[model samples]
Target: MKTILFKSKLIRLFIAFLIFASCSKDDESSTVDIPTVNYTATNFDATFFQTGNSTAPTIDWNGDQGTFSLSAPLAGLNIDSINGILSWDKTLPIGIHNLQVIITNSAGQTVKNITLSNPLQGVFTGFIINGNSEHLEMEFFSDGTIIVKLEDSGSPPTAYGTWTKNNTTIIANLTNPENGVQASFSGTLTIDTTAKYTGNLYSNPNLTDPLGVFEVVLH
Candidate 1:
């Protein structure tokens, strides 16, 4: 009877050990660890102008993943999905434009607002004569009004005129208050940091000045 009781007690201990081991294995298998993810972005703002071979500026960004999108469609610009690259192959209208860019991932998302300025219609200062390095200022407004000023030695010391632009050309009717003479300038304008307009000058409506070569360089 003593021997049978000892064997029964040993069997119970073995069963309990097996149950505990099985439970330990199940708990270890069910346990899982997850990693943390972070998403971030940088902002941007810039100025540009319409040109013959204009390229759009890009926004610098980081921690981007998944999909990328723009708030509105630009006429001649596009954004890359995998990479944040703003592309511009054509010219845009002269004005201030606003846009928003969004980057999304499984972790989170980021948004950035962009302001772009096209300063094609702005005031520029330079020289009006090709060979003469004199101070001349020109203003091109958005309302189709243009003003040109030349600094000369006189009572006012300044000669002013009004002009208009058609496409890439400018036609100006200038007035000399000191000499009481009116002249006109017709030229093709090249817009840049150092903008220029080169063509002919007309002292009279029917005749062009033989020595007049209207060339203006931006300051």
Candidate 2:
């Protein structure tokens, strides 16, 4: 009789254990509530500047990461759109000036602006070249134009070309129809207003090293 009672108690304990396991499994499989993600906006401006009303610059937000606006501005100024760039169409005064811009996107938002000034005016001298000494000098005008004459052999090159400056790079494209060929010289130009320059000239786009790096002082 005792053995039979012990077997019946064991069976009841197994059934109770199975019920508890089922309840724990149900709890593990239960669904959970999740929170929603918030939306935001932003803008991208690697370089920002303002020259005032005299010089109106074209700013490219490139759709600005998303939707946004420009908050900072000169006193008594307005923007064309809230989520894009603002330019000064009127001529700006000749001096350093600050500009402000704001932008936003689906993740967050941002405000940015920069101060810019006109390029420093440089004094220039007439052109000169000496190949024997490996020296070349040319005058660069503030109008973004240049007259460069360089030589390779013991004599100076009679060749002349025009050049222009964009940022720190200078491009000189010249064609010698008499020789039935065209060549381009490009490199970086270090310049200051007092007429000092450090020029690094390259023969091709794949510039291994500057063929000619020299200092030029304008008189």
Candidate achieving the largest lDDT = 1
- Residues 51-105, candidate 2: write the lDDT tens digits: 2222223343333234434454453234545324344422222235465555454
C-alpha TM-scores of all predictions: 0.41, 0.33
Model 2 / residue 152 / CA error / Å: 6.1
- Per-residue lDDT of 192 in model 2: 29
Which digits, one per residue and each the tens of the lDDT, describe model 1 over residues 1-219? 999999999999999999999999987765533222222423332333433322333433333236667878976566777655655532454445676767666545667666555444566665556456566666665554556676665322433566665666677776667777777778787644445667776776443763366566544
Worst 10 residues of 2 by lDDT: 39-48
What stretches of model 1 exceed 4 Å from their correct place?
Answer: 1-120, 130-133, 154-161, 176-180, 205-207
lDDT of 2 at 19: 100
lDDT of each: 0.58, 0.45
